[model samples]
Target: MLLTVSGPPGSGKSTAAAALATALDYEHVSGGDVFRELAEERGMSLGEFNALAEEDDTIDRDLDRRLREISETRDEVVLESRLSGWMAAEHADLRIWLDAPLDVRAERIAAREEKPVEQAREETVTRAESEALRYREYYGIEIDDLSIYDAVLNTARWGPAETTELLVALAESYDPQTDEGTFPVSGVRYEF
Candidate 1:
């Protein structure tokens, strides 16, 4: 049972995903962490990482390949990525999309990274735009779209624990083999 959590920058997707994975005893795989590790290994900054991803198709391909390989063996894994919803279509028992207000997201990023709010806001907007553009150009993927997901969540009102509880409820009600291609039990729709 593969589960995926996706959202825009600073939307608490990682926090919620980790909590969900822990509650369900699932392995957690994060694309953002993978990208960060890869970038560090190559001795590059975040901007450089985005730049390289834009210029190199091989990087994204390799990342996707590794994710696929992991998913094959893990019975219940929580995968978090900008493109997780799309990638997990075949394997995911449930896909969750986390959403938060821009201001809230900016605040979270600033506080978490210890940066000036204005600087964090600028960085967040830039990274978000760059990621959307590059992912589309490089892989024909639009992470902003929620149609690919089984559930859409607004994290602005809920804390990580509450969100995890909700996800667990959804997961408990989900039967992957029979529920394939079905929408979320919550029946919430995201406006593109």
Candidate 2:
């Protein structure tokens, strides 16, 4: 099964995806990790790299293309990225979108990065806006649109354990062989 987990920065997507992968014994690929690695290689901070991305689309396209290739060629892998769900929408068996309030996400970022909450909040907002604009300009994808996701979870309301458990259960029950276009499980909806 190919599962794509996507959310805004600090939405706990990587945590949830990693947990789900461990529980299911599946390989996990994280686009953010890859992006971060690239930034580190160039000795640039994430915000600086993001600004560079505005002037040059190659960086985003390169990472996104790699993600698409992985999603199309791999199975039993959880693909994690902001646009992973959208890029892999046609190939992914399950697409999940995790959501949390901006303030909650900002707090998480602050804690993770060991920065002040206000600074983290500002950086997060700037990065999000930059990504949204670039995504639209380059791929005609609106990052705000979550209609492509098969399942939507509010990370703020549901803790990591609860969210991971729900995803694991969903994965355990999915059957592709006897399936229609919709999810195999009943009561599942593509929600924003």
Candidate 3:
């Protein structure tokens, strides 16, 4: 079973995905880690790489392609990324979207990154705008759409531990035999 955890920054995607993988004894693959490595390889900061990626489609397309391949080849893995749900598409057994209000997410991001809340908030807004445009332009995906996700959780309501427990239970009780189908990938335009 391939589980894809997708959410915006500060939405507990990495924390929950790691915990879920440990509890379920599955491999955890993070697209953020991959992206960060790509940034490091280019001798750029994450923000710098994000800016570069906006101008160079290959950056995101290449990263997304690797993730898509991982999804296609792997089972019993937890894949985490903002686009993992959409990238995995039909290969994903359970696609979960985690979210929180922008303010709450901004605070979380600030605390995690050891930055001022105001700066984090501003960056959050800017990054979201950039991503929304890129997602729409590059893949024909509406970043706001939750229709493709099997479950959408508000990570702000519970702490990371509780969120992981919730996902654990969801994975444990999952019975594909009696399950309704997930939404199909539609209206996507893959550049590669």
Candidate number achieving the greatest TM-score relative to the actual structure: 2
The true-versus-predicted C-alpha distance at residue 74 of model 3, in Å, is 0.5
Q: Candidate 3 overall Cα lDDT vs. reference?
A: 0.88
Candidate 1 Cα outliers beyond 4 Å, as residue runs:
180-192
- Model 1 steric clash total: 0
The TM-score of predicted model 1 comes to: 0.89
Query: Ten-residue segment with the worst summed lDDT in candidate 3?
Result: 183-192
lDDT of 1 by residue, 77-146 (tens): 9999877877667777777889898889999989998889898888888888887886788668876666
Residue runs of model 2 more than 4 Å from their true location after superposition:
180-187, 190-192
Model 2: how far is 164 from its true place, Å? 0.6
Residues 94-149 of candidate 2 have per-residue lDDT tens digits of 88999899999999999999999999999999999999999999999999988788
Please, what are the lDDT tens digits per residue for candidate 3 over residues 17-115? 999999999999999999999999999988889999999999999999999999999999999999999999978878899999899999999998999
Best by lDDT: 2
How many clashing pairs does model 2 include? 0
Candidate with better TM-score, 2 vs 3: 2
Q: What are the Cα lDDT values of the candidates?
A: 0.81, 0.90, 0.88
